[model samples]
Target: MKAGLFIPCYVDQFYPQVAIATLQLLEKLGVEVVYPPNQTCCGQPMANSGFQHLTKGCDELFVKNFANLDYIICPSGSCTLHIKEHLHHDRHEATATAIRSNIYELTEFMTDILKVEKLDASFPHKVSMHQSCHGQRGLKISQMSELVAEPFSKPGKLLQMVKGIELVELSRPDECCGFGGSFCVFEEAVSAKMGKDRVADHINHGAEFITSADMSCLMHMEGILKRQKSKVQVKHIAEILNASL
Candidate 1:
């Protein structure tokens, strides 16, 4: 299938490796992936901060870059959710709608659309899974702990397919890492505390690394883990899925 890769602004700038891993993973699965050289932000930061009405430029650019692709797959759940929910251009509502319908976060695209049951990757480490709020709750890639329903995770399922990887359990599974974009800046103390607690949970449970689909959340927790000089490292799920060892 023809797919366009939507790398979020932060991932493009800070976590380029995650984007690379995502690209490699898709190619390994035999997808014809395309990268729009002029693609920019999904206008999520502005929209989340209560300025969605001003995201017309971003929306238009997104529609222009991705309207023709069979699928627009992104590694970021937060950005994908933003486009799916807030992307709109008054002059081209149909284009906006088409974009939204075709866009999907990486894990969802792999599990739901690709229906991948196995992977040729290996990681011999004990790891914990961090379900980013946008991917887990918004995209419903997995069942939330609060819901009275069956438990399943696309990311977790994919991880299980990899060789020599042990998935650890967290005390409060599916809890937010408190990286709500600007929420971290506005509520510094609370955000830091939440990150610290989340990191501690993974560390206490013997996790060598914490993995999640959202690099934003891992970036937030990485800051806290670094400040504490913790041995635990944060990794994006794409990196693990695409790993050769």
Candidate 2:
């Protein structure tokens, strides 16, 4: 299947490697991937900040660039969730639906669409999983405990299939890492406290590396880890899934 890659602004600026790894994995899996140069922000930063009206230009830009495609894949869950949940055009219900239905986080794309049960990747390290709210909850990409459906899963199972990688459990697995976009700054005390606790849990479990589908959350956790002088490093699931060492 042909898929259009949607890289968020932050990913483009700070985490281009996630996008690169995502593209590489898709190609390795035999899926035709295309990156439209015109593609930029998903209008998420503005929309999530209660400025949905300001996203019109971005919305128009996105529609103009990717409206024709059926599968829109993204490395960052926050960006994909924002676009799927908030991209609006009253006169273009079809366009809105197309955008929402087509978007997929990397893990969902692999386990659901590709039905890829195994990967030829290896990483000899103890890893802790951070379940990002957008990927785990917003998109409903995986089964959440709060839901009534059969237990949803993609991250854990996929990682388990990889050779030499040990999946360590966090003390509070599903708790938010306090990176709710502007929430980090608006509630600095609470956000920092929460992030510190999350990082502490990972360290307590002897995790040398922290991994998640959302880089924003990992970035927040990384900040706290750095300030605390912890040795644990944060990595996106795409990087882990594409791991070689």
Candidate 3:
């Protein structure tokens, strides 16, 4: 099936590889993906900073670019969640609603719409998965720790299918990486401490790499890892899922 690809602005600027990997992985899985060049940020930065009123143009442009697609897929959960929860264009309300309802995070699309049971991929490394708040709590990509329900993880499930990849267990698996967009900019010290704690979980558990569906979270921990000058690296789950190494 055909789907419109929504690569987050940050991903396009700082992490194009993740966007490329997502495109490749989807194509590999028999999806016909189209990237709309006019697409921009889902106005998440403005909305998160309490200037949501400034996103009128952003909302209008987003709906214009993606309204025709049957499904919209994005690599970043934070952006996808933003659009899913806040997309509004007063003149195009119906189209905005459809875009919101049809948009899916990359992993959410894989495990739910694609219903992938296996993959022709390999990643022989000790990797730990970071359950990003947007993907987990917002999108319901995994079971909440507070809930006494049967635990499940769409990302973890996909990782398990990769050959030679060892999905490590974290001491506190679902902790936030403290990259609440502008929160990191405003609450510097607290955000750094929280990120350090989250990164430490993966390091102490001997994780060779940290993987998450949300690059914003990984980017936060990546900064912490760099400050510590450790050899650990952060990768979007798309990179891992699309890997042959």
Candidate whose lDDT is highest? 3
Look at candidate 2 and give me any clashing residue pairs: 143-152
Clashes of each: 1, 1, 0
Candidate 3, superposed: residue stretches over 4 Å from native: none
Candidate 3: the clashing residue pairs are none
Error of 2 at 154 (Å): 0.9
lDDT tens digits, residue span 50-113, model 1: 9988888998899889988899999999999999988888898998898889999999999989
Task: Measure candidate 2: CA RMSD.
Answer: 1.6
Residues 81-125, model 3: lDDT tens digits: 999999998898999999999999999999999999989899999
The lDDT, on a scale of 0 to 1, for candidate 2 is: 0.85
RMSD per model, one decimal: 0.8, 1.6, 0.8
TM-scores for all candidates? Answer: 0.98, 0.94, 0.99
